[model samples]
Structures are given as C-alpha cells and as structure tokens.
Target chain A: GAGVSQSPRYKVAKRGQDVALRCDPISGHVSLFWYQQALGQGPEFLTYFQNEAQLDKSGLPSDRFFAERPEGSVSTLKIQRTQQEDSAVYLCASRSGAGTDTQYFGPGTRLTVL
Target chain B: TQLLEQSPQFLSIQEGENLTVYCNSSSVFSSLQWYRQEPGEGPVLLVTVVTGGEVKKLKRLTFQFGDARKDSSLHITAAQPGDTGLYLCAGHNAGNNRKLIWGLGTSLAVNP
Candidate 1:
C-alpha cells in the first residue's frame, strides 16, 4: 500500500461490547506502534512491535487492551468489555528501521462506545 | 517520567499573522520531531531536529531545537489558512530505545 491503512474508519459499539481495529502498515516496515487519542488530546502510546516481536506493551492502559502483530506487516488492537471511557480514536504508525526514522501514521479508527 | 508540555493548547489568528508554539521538557532528548495533523486524518511529519541548537526552515515555517536538547519551538511566519491544524512535538530519549514521548499538541486555527 502507498500508506498505512486502518479498518472501520468509524465504529459505534454498545458498552461492554468487544471491538477490534486493524492496521496495515507500509510494506516491509520494521517498526509498528499503536496509540489512543481521546477527544481534544494528543495520541498516547499503547504498544510497539519490532518485526512481530512485541517488545513494548508498557503503555497499554489495562487488561482490556491487547495488540498483536502476527506477521509484522499487519496489526490488530482488540478491546474487551469496552466502556464509555474507552471511546477514542485508535491510531497506528510505522517506521522503517530504528533510530531517528520518521513514523508514518494511519488515518485511525474512531471508536464511539455508547 | 519524561514528558513534553506544549503551550497555547489552542490558538486562533487571522491569516498573515505570525505565531509561535513551544514544547518544553525537563529531560534531554537525542532527537525531536514536529508533526501537523488535520481533522479526521493522522499527523504528518514536518521536521526533525537531531543536534542541539539546530535550526531548520521549511518555507514559511521555522523550527528550533534548544541548546540543551530539552525544548523546541515552531514558528510560522505570515500564517495562512492552510496552516491550520494540530501541531505536535515528539522526542526520542537518549537511551537508544525507539520509544517516543509526545507532547500534548497545539491546535492552531488561521482564519482568512
């Protein structure tokens, strides 16, 4: 793909429902990141992956948040028992290698828990 | 924890006016990057400053990294409506880790 792509641009889920958001990073990119951005706030790091190896999950808010990059090219962020507070835009970004490489971001999935 | 704080959470100015947004941190960084985001879209990288005391210019926009590598600023000269967006600053710690700490971001609105 020309750029990072996310699925379900907009989603509305009832409280307690589980939802999954997907991201397709740029071809052959080695680094992948997931972030959550609340209304009127900047994106907060959620997790990071280095070639299918989940190196960093320190930013995941709680047990309900889980992310995986099985093949290192596409990733999924799953939220279990979603709450009203879970409503936010989920963003995915990718970088080529490591140090100082620029990160390209996806359009993001806007999740609305009603 | 290393944190980046951005000033003027929101700014509205007339076209042709000049403005500057700042990002500050207490910890030093190896590199800092500036990004601009529009509504319904993800942020796009605008510039990256690696060396302390470095200054980079992108047409009407100018970016500077602090001498101590703990702060940075973005200045726009003769702003235009096209420049209206959310500006964010992110920095990588010097520990060789790839994690980036992001600022709160400055939302700028340039009205024509």
Candidate 2:
C-alpha cells in the first residue's frame, strides 16, 4: 500500500463489549507502534513491534488491552470488556528501521464506548 | 520516565502574525522530530534535528534545537491559515531503543 492503513475508521460499542482494531503497515516496514489518544490529549504509546517480535508492551495500560503482530505486516489491538475510559482514538504507526527513523501513521480508528 | 513539556497548549492568531511554540525536557535526546496534524488525520513529519544547536528552516517555518539538546522550538513567520494545526515534538533517548517520548501538542489556529 502507499501508506499505513487501518480498519474500521469508526466503532461504537457498548460498555463491556469487546472490539478489535486492525492496522496494515507500509509494505516491508520493520517497526510498528500502537498508541492511544484521549480527547484533547496527545497520543500515548501502547506497544511496539520489530517484525514479528513484540519487544515493548510496557505502555499497555492494563490487562484488558492487548496487541499482536503475528505475521509482521499487519497488527491487531483488542480490547476486552471495554469501558468508558477505553473510548479514544487508536493510532498505528510504522517506521522503516530503528534509531530516529521517520514514522508513517495510519488515519486511526475512533472508538466510542457508549 | 522521560517527559517532554510543551508550552501554549492552544494559540489563535490572525494571518500574517508570527508565533513560536516551545518544547522542553530535562533529559537530553539523541534526536528530536516535529509533526503537524490536522483534524481526522495522522500527524505528518515536519522536521528532525539531531545535533545540538541545529537550526532548520522550511519556507516560512523555522525550527531550532537547544544547545543542550534538551529543548526545541518551532517558529512560524507571517503565519497563514494553512499553518493551523496541532504541532507535536518527539524525542528519542540516547540509546538503541527507538521509542519516542512525546510532548503534549500545541494547537495553533491562524485565522484569516
């Protein structure tokens, strides 16, 4: 693809419902990142992947938040029993390599837990 | 935890005016990057400064890195309505880890 692509541009789920968001990064990019952006706030890092390896999950807020990059090209972020606090924009970004490399971002999925 | 503090959470100015936004941190960074984001869209890269005391200009926009590598500033000369957007600064630590520490963005509105 020309740029990173994310699925379900918008999702509205009732509290306690589970939802999954997907991201397709630029072809052959080696680094992937997930972030959570709250209303009127900057995006906060959620997780990072290098190819198929999930090297950093320190930013995941709680056990309810999970992310995986099984094949190294696409990634999924799943939220279990979503809460009102979980309502935010989920952003995915990819970089060609490591160390100060520029990142390309997807449009992001806006999740609204009602 | 590495923290980057950005000033002027919001700014509104008339077209042709000038403005500057600042990002500060106590920790030094190996490199710093600036991004601009519009509503319903992802942030796009503006510039990256690696060396301390480096300055880069992109047409009407100018970016400067602090001599200590702990701060940066984005200045727009004769700002136009097209420059209205959210500006963010991200810093990479001095290590192999490529994770970025981001600053709370500055939202600028240049009204015509």
Candidate 3:
C-alpha cells in the first residue's frame, strides 16, 4: 500500500522476552515517528527520525526501548526485557517533510505482555 | 511538558444523534489536528486547524480551533453508525519540528 505498514499486527510476549516491531513508511517520506498507545489513552510519542538521524528519543519510556531507521526508509522498534506495562499498540507514522506535513499512520502493532 | 486532555472519554449514541468532543491543553500549539481511528487501525487525519478561531468542516464533522490555540473541538451533526470510532486531537509542538502531542482519544459508539 502507499501508506505506512507495520509488521506483526499482534504480538504476545512473556515478561523479560524481547520483541521487535517493524514499520515501512510511504516511499520518499522524510520523517518517521513511533508512538505508544496504552488502552484508553492517546498515542504518546516515543521517538522521531528525520531520515537516518534520530533527532529525538526523549519520549521513550525507558532505556529498554530503542528505535532506528537505517538507510532512511524502513524502521524498527526493539524492546528489551518486556514488561506487562509494555502492552500497548505501537503506531508508526511518516510525514513528507519538516513543517505542516500531514502524517500517514500504519495499522499499528498491538503488543500484549504477559 | 505538554499534555492534551479530552473530555467524555467514552460516548454511546444512536445513529443520527449529534455529539461534540472537546480537547483542551494549557500549552499553546502552532497547529491542531483531528484524527479518527477504528479498532485495530491507526488514526486517519480528518482536519488540521492552524489559525486561531478557525473552523473547518468535513461532511458532518465540524472542527474548531480555539483563539488561544490551546484547545479545539469536534462536533458531529447527525452522526451515523459509520462514525463510530475513536476521535483524537493532536497539537504540534513547535519546539520539536516533527513531533505532535496527542490527547487521549474519545471513543464513540454509534448504534444504528
């Protein structure tokens, strides 16, 4: 599809198990964003990447959460030693450019930790 | 820290009913955007209000941006069953060129 796409529509991991979510953005998109959405809450910013550079990751909940957009296209969000609180939908979005660009979002990966 | 709060966290109404959802924040934003998300799918952009006191309409949905740029609202006229979904409001943080602060969405269920 022309819109952003994320892998593993649903994932269930045991506590302490690691999981990696993938996102494929629209072709030629310059900005990519990762968000965590807890049930009954909004999607909170986790990290942002402008091309291959990760400009902001201050929103990541913990050091175990890591993301990267290598080669400036597809991106990956890796969570180490997952916890029950990590259960949430992970959403990926991409924008065309810097300012005022409309964000196109993916179907999102729902991670369930047990 | 910037935070957006949405009212009526959950709403249930019959088709053809009218409803309004509100989003408020103390922080000023350069732009405010509305999105609709279905279960298991990501949000789709509905509208973006940049100018203060600006009002934009999309079909039965009308969006308004507050004069202070710290709040916005979405009003639906004669809502339909198809309109059942989570409505989200997001405001752009000028400090972060590409980041948007999101409000906890209002989940609306329209029964036919």
Measured against the true structure, the TM-scores of the candidates, in listed sequence, are 0.98, 0.98, 0.97
Ordered list by lDDT, greatest first = 1, 3, 2
Candidate 3: TM-score? 0.97
Clashing pairs in 1: none
| Candidate 3 local lDDT, A1-114, one digit each (tens) | 778999999999999999999999999999999999988678999999999999999889999999999899999999999999999999999999967779999999999999
lDDT of 2 by residue, B1-112 (tens): 9899998999999999999999999999999999998888888899999999999999999999999999999999999999999999998889845578889899999999
Error of 3 at B48 (Å): 0.2
Which regions of candidate 3 fall more than 4 Å away from where they truly are? none
| DockQ-derived CAPRI band for the predicted complex in model 3 | high
lDDT of each: 0.94, 0.93, 0.93
Per-residue lDDT tens digits for candidate 2, residues A34-113, read 99987656789999999999999999999999999999989999999999999999999999986468999999999999
Poorest 10 consecutive residues by lDDT, candidate 1 chain B: B95-104
Q: Tell me the lDDT of candidate 2.
A: 0.93
lDDT for B67 (candidate 1): 98
The interface root-mean-square deviations, each candidate in sequence, come to 1.1, 1.2, 1.0
Instruction: Please give the distance, in angstroms, between residue B63's alpha carbon in candidate 1 and its true position after superposition.
Output: 0.2
Indicate the DockQ of the complex predicted as candidate 2: 0.72
Q: Which ten residues in a row have the lowest lDDT in candidate 2 chain A?
A: A36-45
